[model samples]
Target: MSNKSSLNLEAINDFIVNWLKSYAENAKVKGFVVGISGGIDSALTSTLCAQTGFPTLCVEMPIHQAESHVNRANEHIDQLKARFSNVFNERVDLTPVFEMFKNQVSTSDNEAVLNLTLANTRARLRMTTLYYLGGLHGFLVVGTGNKIEDFGVGFYTKYGDGGVDISPIADLMKSEVRQLAAYLQVPDSILKAKPTDGLFGDDRSDEDQLGASYDELEWAMLEVEKGKKPEDFEGRKAEVLKIYKRLNSSNQHKMQAIPVCLLPDKLKLL
Candidate 1:
């Protein structure tokens, strides 16, 4: 998010690889299981996992995913497999599973909420598939979300993309991720590809839904973090602030831990 590019890709890669290896050893897990969506975040995350010398299960769980998205996903996996001996690629199409789910849910009057529910179902189904694979193979589910998506706007689904044993690049901003992906030699096509969750049939990009570019959001998020008010943006204050507030407020729930009621000794008597 900072205009200053201070990220040391080599160091980041080394740190992530070491973390994965140590995590696997300490957690007694066999390897890392990653859900690849052909996006830069997943590609970078999977690459880091593969570099750890542990068997990395790179899965493409496509549920009504776009053809371009599918192609890019395969290309990235092929590249990773070609270079990293520990990289194992798997493609699990969940279209049938999603269709079955749609059939089961009762029709609702609110079409908008229904569509959103179905989209969230797609993400949760993918989460289920990742955990199933991890459970069967004794691997840890590695998530692909970057800082901007995971924290800035809470762009990920809870118990869905948000479900994972580890997150390697959750601290890196979207811009920083692109820089790291380029350094990792992620395929040029993938490195230059538009960022999308590939969850909807309409094939909308993240920027499209967010109504602001990652650069803009990143700047605004940083400003918010610095305790700067919307008025600080000067001429574009109102416009940028609107985008910032809408995104931060709408997705705040995803960024937080599940709520639980705590009881003290006296309250426990109830």
Candidate 2:
């Protein structure tokens, strides 16, 4: 969304390298625990963390019921398994977890809530695995989310995909994610692929879930960046604001740090 001109990804990578170094040193974190879903987002994120010298632990979490997509997801993991030095690649089948939570929980009359609940379950399950790894090695979880998918459409599950110690690429739009993927020389299979949560039907993708493509989301975000509303664009006004609220409202908490009231002595000697 920060203009269509290509970015100097070397500078981007350099900035992240310093950020990662400072973050780990200050936080005293052992390393990074990354969830690699064989998707472009995860692949690009993992590659960035690894290239920047973090000992990234990449996990492939999938529900056994969705075995086919799981297999497809592993291909992305396999590529990284061959690259990172201290990578931990494991496939934890989440079928039992999903089944247990699904059976014990009673749904309300709302179908939308039901679907969202299931998706959140999948997301939380993945986060559980990531956190487990983080606990084992004192690593911090690295988020794979990008601006367009989670930030633009409010598509991620709160407290689910929202759980992370740090996000290396949360500021990036979906198109910019692909651009970084290209910069990292990520495989073409992932570079040009559709983005999906792998929580719903195998056919469902991010664009379909959001009712708009990355191109549309990018246009809308750019318009917002220029302090213009959807009405300024003529026919797309309604659609633009609809997404504007989604992008703006849904990501409110994600864009901020939790409130920690300053103590009286906190500013004593700054």
Query: Which prediction has the highest TM-score against the true structure?
Result: 1
Number of clashes found in candidate 2: 0
Per-prediction CA RMSD (Å): 1.6, 4.4
lDDT of model 2, residue 129:
83
* TM-score, predicted candidate 1 vs. hidden true structure: 0.95
Give the per-residue Cα lDDT of candidate 2 at 238.
52
Return the TM-score for each candidate structure: 0.95, 0.86
Q: Give the 10-residue window scoring lowest on summed lDDT in candidate 2.
A: 64-73
| Model 1: lDDT of residue 227 | 88
* Inter-residue clash pairs, candidate 1: none
Off by over 4 Å in 1: 1-4, 235-237
lDDT of 2 at 266: 61
Full-model lDDT, candidate 1: 0.88
Instruction: State in Å the error of residue 165, model 2.
Output: 0.2
Report the Cα lDDT for residue 137, model 2: 88
C-alpha displacement of 142 in model 2, angstroms? 0.7
Which one is best on lDDT?
A: 1
